[model samples]
Target: MPIVQVEMLEGHTLAKKRLMVEKVTEAIVESLGVPADKVTIIIRDMSKENFSKAGKLACDQ
Candidate 1:
């Protein structure tokens, strides 16, 4: 079993997220030889204000 975590800024379309999961699952299945049903994917979405870079909030950039 493989547990994958992905974090990204909010507002991604459902299509994009679906494609991401499909690709990620394929990679995991190919690399780890794990069953697709056994793989776990966790996606966390946050606002731009929740992240910072160079001492500035991402939302401010």
Candidate 2:
């Protein structure tokens, strides 16, 4: 079984997430010989305030 965890800032369409999951699962199944049913994908959404970049808070200046 393969477990994939994707963490990113919260702002993605359902279609995008679905595509990602499908592509990731296919890759895992092809590369690791895992069954499609055995692959699990988890998407974690974080608020901008909870993330930062370039020494600055993502939600603030």
Candidate 3:
């Protein structure tokens, strides 16, 4: 089984996430020759306030 982890800022709709996972699964299946059921996807939704870049909080930017 292949596991994929994705982390992005929160605010995406369920439809977008569903499409993203579908595409990701297709890619993994094609590259690894693995079944779709064998691919695992873990999505982490992060808050902008908890993320920062270049000494500036994401929420501040």
Give Cα-based local distance difference scores for all models: 0.93, 0.91, 0.96
Candidate ordering by TM-score (highest first) = 3, 1, 2
Top-TM-score structure, candidate number? 3
Segments in model 1 whose C-alpha atoms lie over 4 Å from true places: none
lDDT for each residue of candidate 2 in 22-60, tens digit (9 for 90 to 100): 998999999998799999999999998888889888899
> On lDDT, who's better, 1 or 2?
1
Cα RMSDs of all predictions?
A: 1.0, 1.6, 0.9
TM-score attained by model 1: 0.89
Per-candidate TM equals: 0.89, 0.83, 0.91
Descending-lDDT candidate ranking: 3, 1, 2
Q: 41, model 1: CA deviation in Å?
A: 0.8
Q: In model 1, what lDDT does residue 44 have? A: 97
In angstroms, the error of model 1 at 33 is 1.5
User: lDDT tens string, model 3, 1-61?
Assistant: 9999999999999999999999999999999899999999999999999889999889999
RMSD in angstroms between candidate 2 and the native structure over all alpha carbons: 1.6
Clashing pairs in 3: none
**Model 3 — which ten-residue stretch has the worst lDDT?**
48-57
